[model samples]
Target: MRKGKLYLIPTVIAEETQAVVIPPHILQALPGIQYFLAEDIRTARRYLSSLKVYESIEPLIFEVLNKNTKADQLKKFFEPVFQGNDLGILSESGCPGVADPGSLAVKFAHEHDIQVVPLVGPSSILLALMASGMNGQRFAFHGYLPIDGKDASAIVKTLEKESRSKNQTQIFIETPYRNNTLMAVLMKSLADDTQLCIAVDVTGKDESIRSYSVKKWKSIPVTFPKSPAIFLFLSH
Candidate 1:
């Protein structure tokens, strides 16, 4: 009989950077683990090292896509998680499956009746929404905007108008490198007085979050931060 192992999932939230709270729970469980299934193997190693843990952690790559290769990836990646061997699912940044990789593994675990535990910590999306000053009751994370050079003008217009009509905060994000480009599109396409919020490097040493009207960013020449960030547009 195979003994089912409990997974000690770690959140890559900003608060987890220090050796405290939620991170310690996962960090303590890393030693003598059967395996480690991570979105990025290198990042997982770094997180372990940051905590002064020197266990020989094995790597299992998990994907977010829905292709055949994705299933193979999950099988190859998360097989140990179900068979009584503890395998931790970690996001490169933030919580897994919340705009990060690891949902597929969770789904697999659930399907196989494997207990999945999520350790809570700093969440950039929730943190951004709480600071947005928008309607908290009604909100949607639209993930990343089009990256294939799609009409960003039309996308922003639609998001702005929809938010205004529904009285909801439309939240979205982009890659760290394309931060400025998204800001430009938001200013040009959205209304002049639209409220925009940018939460950059949420829990890091250089963290910054600014909320202002679109017009305010105009004169300021909004060059979005190059660090990891979350942006939200409010219409209330």
Candidate 2:
């Protein structure tokens, strides 16, 4: 029997903007996917239902795949593929197999000789970089920085030093609730000449993308909201 292919499906980064951020072709392809591995089954079902490609979501199969998922559980998640059934991986937001835990599934598929196809969709990381006006030619994404006060500051300075030395853009994110904390550390740690870009709610109605020098950022009195955001910097 021919092995089924593994599709890396991308989901909307923000709610209520699915039609705007998700492409028509992605919607058209959803109807053909019956098996999915999602970080959250409820939200995954709701998102698929919103696309309105299926007559009924009850027939679709969803299995949990999150940070807590272990290597021993890979066989169970990809069982359908072994039986010649296509499988899809969905992230809680943005593209799967990125910063999300979906990479494990992708690795499993590769090991089993299952074809992997990544569909196009919104990725907050890429969108932020595109709008940042920073050096996109050479860049690195550090999923999340240390939350400790001293550690976060040290890492920020280290990344800035690396960016200056290599002329590369350094990108990172923080938990929504800790936005202000991280922002505070960034403001205090980075040199005044460093360029900083704060892209908040990309592809959302209240989207805000601002690129300014650390000096300017210090002068501005701002408090980051509890919303999904991306932070990038480049040092001279």
Q: Which predicted model would earn the best TM-score?
A: 2
Per-residue lDDT, model 2, residue 37, is 95
For all candidates in order, the CA lDDT equals 0.70, 0.93
Q: What is the lDDT of residue 15 in candidate 2?
A: 79
Which residue pairs clash in candidate 2? none
| Count of clashes in candidate 2 | 0
Q: Which ten residues in a row have the lowest lDDT in candidate 2?
A: 24-33
> Which candidate wins on lDDT?
2
What TM-score, computed on C-alpha atoms, does each candidate reach?
A: 0.84, 0.98
Tens-digit lDDT string for candidate 2 (1-236): 88888988899998799878888888877887899999999999999999889999999999999999999998998888888988999999999988999999998888888999999999999999999999999999999998799999999999999999999999999899999999999989999999999999889888899999999999999988889999999999
Error of model 2, residue 140, in angstroms:
0.8
